[model samples]
Target: MTVFAAEQQFHDAEASLPSHQARLACRAGLAQTTAGVAPGYIQGNLAILPETYAAAFHRFCQLNPKPCPIIGMSDVGDPMIPSLGTDLDIRTDLPRYRVWRDGELVEEPTDITAHWRDDLVAFVIGCSFSFEEALLADDIPIRHIEQKVRVPMYRTNISCAAAGPFAGPMVVSMRPLKPKDAIRAVQITSRFPSVHGAPVHLGLPQSIGIADIDKPDYGDPVRIEPDEVPVFWACGVTPQAVIAAAKVPFAITHAPGLMLVTDLKNKHLAVL
Candidate 1:
């Protein structure tokens, strides 16, 4: 199905559910971007690794807070992260998962039960979707949601702080907005530091090493009107890039735009 068709189907079937029910739908095999689902609740990016690499990866997140603000973590070998949701199963709660082996994407699975390992550690990173709710509440237009597509994300020239076999260039999500709205977005998103906080770069994509605005490194592209400027925010997808660069033997991450929905309210994450 086309992006619009898939989004419409997801909207009609599950967009308005509460967090727990949204997860239940994912666990039931409904795979699609989690962008507009469970709007008021917090959503997160997933990264699972072996316990042998967990400490370094944890330090990587701490070193590079903007692109890896951790929201929740699972106990080693446990699929449940009760702080995120009592029933949130790391192996099955996300709509889709990307399994990586030696830095290469080996599979995109709807359920990861077959791949779950005893030494695995799951990390939940704060997602831009959590802050998008605030932007929408403030009347800011989110083009990806309006266009029924995943947000455009690109790898930038900016480098992340390296932490023991975990290092890569930063990745950012973009939203095109008119100059005035871009300013408002900065002010609005800055209040939620845990969810990326604010625009990391604006207007000139080339300044950030993005050669073509139409093509993105990850996620789908959206139109950029002449009156609008593309705003970039650090994305949670940085870990996937790091995994590729580090060439870790094994790893699992939520498919771009697909997330783990949590019971925590978005408002609860705001600094203001």
Candidate 2:
């Protein structure tokens, strides 16, 4: 199906239900981007690792707050993160998951119940989708969502603070916005630091070592009109890239746009 069709189907299903209801749809294999689903609820990016590497990864998030803000974390061997939601299940809640072995993507599974291990730990990182609602509320247009595609993401030359083997270049997601809107976006997003708040870089993608704006390391590229400048923000996907670079024995993350929806509302995340 086309992106538009998938988005339309999601919209049609999501328009009537509460956040939990929408999540149930996702859990039942409605597997589509969680962009507009559960509009008011906070959406998080998932990262699961074994206890052996959990401490290092936790420190990694703390050291690099911009790209990896910890929203919720699971107790060892537990799939439920009570802080995120009353009935959250990390193994089956997300629409899609990417399983890694020795840092290489081994599978993109719909559920990870079978992969769950006794020493496994799950981390719920804050996502940009939490802030997009604020941007939309302020009438700041997000072109990727408007175009029914995933946000464009690029890997930069900027290195993250190394935590054990969990070190790699920062990954960013881009949105094309005019100067005025970009300025407004900075103010709006900055209020929610729990989610990656504000633009890390604006314009000159090459300065960040992005060789081709048309080719993104992750996600589909969106059009960047001449009148608009590209705004880059720290993305939760950074951990996944770091996992590959670190070559950890095993890991799992949410598929790019398929996020984990939580009961926490976006408004609750704002600091101002």
Candidate 3:
């Protein structure tokens, strides 16, 4: 769950986001926006690269279908990711972005103008939030979204297909749910392939190498009721974890939950 209220706003996107607001926020230096800005819209996980590594990264995403599912991309030196939304500018749509150098986190910036390069390319990936929308549509309660807390995310032992310098374990997001609801979610989410289709693992997290249930590598911890076993899904974090480990000379990604809100509606991606 993300606190839509907790996200700090720079300049309102005239009551819209992703296209117009991204440019506005990037211009204002509000790198991190917390709350869900575009209700009922599809938001994305972001990844940016220089020309030298764009080909390799592109191949990496293609090879690792589940963890790095590509949604939209840009040609080298093009800030406009036309595939996602009309006039969508990659450099300024997301509220926050992470700057990496030599595989190390160097800075967290709202805008990357100082770091932008002609060789740079950007990628937008499918997010689990789209699936969560499906679950909610079925009346399955999401604890974090309801309580305004960050969903728990864990680094797993699952390996991703390596392409060039990119290779790392898959990360997953957790949500607590009753067994019946979890089962139904599996059936409902299987239809949307473009938005991270369904839950990868559902019970006994240790089976996947997550030693501690309460501890998470990203996001915050949520309650685990006795009647509710922890349910896990392949997350957008998988790519970020891989990028951080790969340690490319320079790379950028959206801060967790600070998604690239697109004009695309969640219904547009729904298979039903």
Candidate 4:
């Protein structure tokens, strides 16, 4: 089969699994971008660090809530975050993980069990995937999902508020939408603040230091139709950028598009 055919097969098999099943798929070595998968479930960006950096990182999220809203966190050394899902295992639940050492990405592992440490703490930051469900429900088109590609994300001129040893330019995810849909998307996503609600900027990608909209810093790029304007949202991936800049001795983050699928329903996070 062709690569596109295989990808479509993968998407069909994973896209509607219940939250726990999705986690099981990930734990079993099924690595794929989590976008549009397990719809209506809340997905999160994962970040793990040693206990020594946990407090500082928590402060970083608190300081920059837009890109780092805390959804669920694990107690030091424990992989399970019971609040997110009784069966969720941080070390193995995500489809893929980025292992960092001294601010350098050293590995992208399907399982972090071998790299797990007794002093590590896990943080689950709210993901835009949750809000995409809201957008779809509103009939707003999501180019990346429709194209079966990972959403395009870019680093911006905007800087996140810093905390001890954690600071970097904010990263944002982009989705192109028609003007009317853009307005409605803003309204729809605004109700889910914990999930990186609403567009931080719309149109003018160059204004955010993105010179070529077709080339993204992370994830796959989708075409922006002539009638559509690119809408940007502060992304949970911002932590990875900060981690790279901070050069923490050790760190782990979810691969850009592969998130931690949670038991919590997307609706549970809506402000309405």
Candidate 5:
């Protein structure tokens, strides 16, 4: 099958399944970015860390609210976070997971069930997928989605306030938009504070320490046309960067663009 045909099939399968079942499919190896999956459902970035570091990480998130908005968290030593979704299993929900050891990526796995530990705490952070859905509703184009690729993410020079071992460069996701559309996006996204709210930086990538517009630190890159400017937003993936910077003994995160499918609807996260 052509890539487009496979893409359509993936979308169709995702559309047919409820959130948990979609997650089950993901566990079964149907790897794809969670971007358009499950329609209105809230997709979340995952971070699982030892309980010893949980408090400091929580504080870190609180200090850097824009990039690390907490959507849901599992009790220490538990795999299930019932508030995020009924029967949610942190080890197997997302399509892919990144296992980090002392700030290095040690594995990209389909399931982390074997890695689960009693001292671990799971965190779910709000993702840009919520607002991207809002943008599409208003007929705004999402270049990465149109190109059938992951959104571009970068590690910027902007630093997060430190909390124990949970400090790092602020990571932002990029979306190229024409000037007028960008203005409208700010208006549309402002309503969703739980999901990173609005753009943090626009136009000049260099201002945020993004050295090259075409080369992103994470996820797939898309074109930035002459008529368009790149808009950057605080991203949930910031935690992974923080984990790397802190060099914690062990950590786990959703692979960039792969998110946990949640029962909570995107509309439920909107502040407006």
Candidate 6:
């Protein structure tokens, strides 16, 4: 089915449900960033690698569950991610893509058929954005959304476990929350292990080796409140870091804030 055609088949109600049409709009190239897409639906970070390294990469994700939780994975040469939806195709589902070669990002394309190969495995990792629903449900204000910017992501000194050709330090995405709301966020997010679960650390960025909070390694930086503490979570960027460190010949990832909208509801990912 055409991407838009397939989406219209789903039931999406804005008042009693999150608008699937609005969600489809973002996925159909209407929005440049997904700071706020399907408010109560799960979003993901994407990574695709050639078959030669897919086995080791899968193991790497299994070993490092926090940063690389695999929500959907496709067979080599397959664009479908059945676990995520009834008819999801990795190639055209996302609004944007980043093509990397030998660890260097060479192009940002809306469609990747020119780069698709017979030996590639696509991975859809859970995004912390998945938890924004819970956070909003409980009334935690998201600064980036209010400002309409990408969530700030940073490279940390924390190192990830090495697996064959995949190894690198963890990358984290930060959100500033009032002390009380931060605790609630921790409680709300803990239920979704498929997306990231729980805060890795809070209050101090330097302790985790983040030198410049104002300058993020990826995504745009958001403002921090003096009354709020910056909370950090293990991010999907960790895999990109691994790909860069390993210097893989070729790889593809979603452009930072653009994501694949799946048929799986955010409620389905909740532990309770």
RMSD of each: 6.8, 6.5, 6.3, 6.7, 6.2, 4.2
Per-residue lDDT of 154-268 in model 6, one digit per residue for the tens? 8888888888999888998899999999999899989988878998889989999988899999889999989999999899888978987788999999987788777678888
Summarize candidate 1's per-residue lDDT along 1-272 as a digit string, tens digits.
Answer: 99999999788656444888889899999998787787789999899999999999999999999999999999999999998885789999899999999999999999999999999999999998878889999999899989988889999999999999999899999999999999999999999999998889999999999999899988899999989999999998888789878889999999887899999999999898
The top-ranked prediction according to lDDT is: 1
Models ranked on TM-score: 2, 1, 5, 4, 3, 6
lDDT of 5: 0.90
Q: Judged by TM-score relative to the true structure, which candidate is superior, 3 or 5?
A: 5
Name the weakest run of 10 consecutive residues (lDDT summed) in model 1: 9-18
Instruction: Tell me which residue pairs clash in candidate 1.
Output: none
State model 1's lDDT.
Answer: 0.91
Misplaced by over 4 Å in model 5 are 1-17
lDDT of each: 0.91, 0.90, 0.81, 0.90, 0.90, 0.83
Q: What are the per-residue Cα lDDT tens digits for candidate 2 across 68-124? A: 999999999999887888667888888999999997999998889999998999999
lDDT of 3 by residue, 1-272 (tens): 25664353422334555545544555566655534665667788999988888898899888877777898888889899776786677776677788988889888787777777898999899987778887898999998888788889998877778899888888889999999998988888788777777878888788888999889988998988899978888888888888888888889998887778777788788777
User: How big is the positional error of residue 235 in model 2, measured in Å on the Cα after superposition?
Assistant: 0.8
Which ranges of candidate 2 are over 4 A from the true structure? Answer: 1-17
Candidate 5: 10-residue stretch with minimal lDDT = 12-21
lDDT for each residue of candidate 4 in 1-272, tens digit (9 for 90 to 100)? 99999999788667544888889899999999887677788889889999999999999999998999999999889899989985889988999999999999999999999999999999999988888888888888789888888889999998888899999899999999999999999899899989888789999989888999989998889998898999999998899889889999999999888899998999989898
Off by over 4 Å in 1: 1-17
* TM-scores of all candidate predictions against the true structure: 0.91, 0.91, 0.89, 0.90, 0.90, 0.88
Instruction: Return the lDDT, model 5, position 187.
Output: 95
Off by over 4 Å in 4: 1-17
Q: Candidate 5's residue-wise lDDT over 62-172, tens digit each? A: 999999999999999999998988778889888999999999999999899999999999999998999999999999999998998888999999988999978888999
Candidate 3 global TM-score: 0.89
